[model samples]
Target: MQNPASANANVTVTVTATATVSDFAELPATASHGPLRIEYRWVNERAGDAPIAVFLHEGLGSIAMWRDWPQTLCERLGMRGLVYSRPGYGLSTPRPHAQKWPADFMTAQACDILPALLDALSIDRDERGRMWVIGHSDGGSIALLYAALHPEALAGAVAIAPHVFVEDISVESIAQTKQLYETTDLRSKLSRYHADVDSAFYGWNDIWLDPAFRQWSIAGEIASIRQPLLAVQGHDDNYGTMAQIDTIAARVPHAQLVKLDACGHSPHRDAPEALNEAIAAFVLKISAS
Candidate 1:
């Protein structure tokens, strides 16, 4: 267990072994958004025939940010798992300052980019049937949105501390993070993993804090997600409130909400044992059905 002191009184204690690149299959990904070339890495290696589980990282997350959770859970469940960095995070392409993400950036990812990436790797969504998605923070919201938009493309989804709508608290927290990134060495530290950390950080932070983004809420989309769903939240998340998961439960009929005590925004990082156990059981139940 690693306990890190934070500006917030609620400190974050993370428990899990960090995995190296060797633990994953670093497959190169290629896609196109006009003339821009997008790059990504995929980790999907399992010994058995369990359902494929795709992992989406958080706002500041990458394949490295996920640590060993993917390998751990996939091994425990005898399932295949995939972890990849999005357009602006980790080793993926940096977001150009000259261009702005569309208002429906997340929608586009779920509707277009993600499918393109899957196709690039020859993972036939229609033939493989439906793959399970395990997403954290912003990635979690993306997963939920993807399930909602393409209900037939997913077997189920698990979201951890997902953001559905912008809140005053979220904006305030991000403002503090901006200060940390600039004044402190947070940006430098992140640079070790990301080639252009600022691009990744500001790209995500700025768009989320935009005034118009407050109107960005996918709770309405949740009503359309018919697949079995699991929403997990930590009691001590500094990013967003529990309402994120509550809204999901209110909309999706088969949604299961797991609230962990003494946990934070990233449940797989803060409580890996509990998370792995829950995911294994949930996957088993789904497979049985």
Candidate 2:
């Protein structure tokens, strides 16, 4: 549990995902992950008339880990923004050391926790209809799942390096990362962002390396997303191949694809200009339609 003194009292949640459309409303809003006190921040918070951009971070990411990218992109798109650290990462509740994430963990996040946060913030149905979801890596996968589950809720989504299915290469890279995390200064570096760095790191790291997690995939699931989606990837990405976005474009036929040259798993960091331009154009086109 986080010391209440440091967390945002306005955002601490006591309600379950059962919040409704009238004011607020599951992995169905009903699948409870129990109580979570999330850590979040608002960008352009006074821009009441503009649409909201909800950002979900990568597997090992926290709000601070996202740096200034969310604020920059939301500004370019003329939108307000919400960025938060999920439970078990950053200042949010830490994952119990004994807990091993189930295969449907990402699904649970999309359906259960994210909605609860939106509700906790008093972002009702109408706001959600005009909202955009932007996420990276595992966060990207959660964004896709949220759109699929609540097809009527979002304006669209920008998924950067999202995984729809597990690949041999992904498992291989994660395996290598485990080695690096132990042998290098990775833990020291990541500790700057997370209160319980081990909770954030090991919770994410242990799951991907688990043999059973190899079969985890949302490939068939994302096919249900009805909104416009832009899938971006770097040709040189070490974590996943272009097949991640390609699969999204194929499954969600209207989904646009942007494969960046000389980029890696994190486009916002590697190619900010190109990524910002692509997302701005996509949001503009969708908003006008």
Best by lDDT: 2
Cα miss at 153, model 2 (Å)? 0.7
lDDT of 1 by residue, 1-289 (tens): 0001111122222213322342111223335364323333444453545567888888888766776778878788776876777777665667887666655778767776666666655677563465888888888988988888877778888888898887787888888888898999898777765557777888887887678878888888879988888899889998888888888888886799889888987788788888877877887898788
- Candidate 2 per-residue lDDT, tens place, 119-231, comes to 77778889999999998999999999999999999999989998888888888888887788899998788777777888888888888888898888799999999999999
- What are the per-model numbers of colliding residue pairs? 0, 6
The deviation in Å at residue 133 for candidate 1 is 0.6
Model 2 segments more than 4 A misplaced: 1-32
Q: C-alpha displacement of 125 in model 1, angstroms?
A: 3.6
Go through the candidates in order and give each one's C-alpha lDDT: 0.73, 0.82
lDDT of 1 at 55: 85
Runs of candidate 1 with Cα error greater than 4 angstroms are: 1-32, 35-49
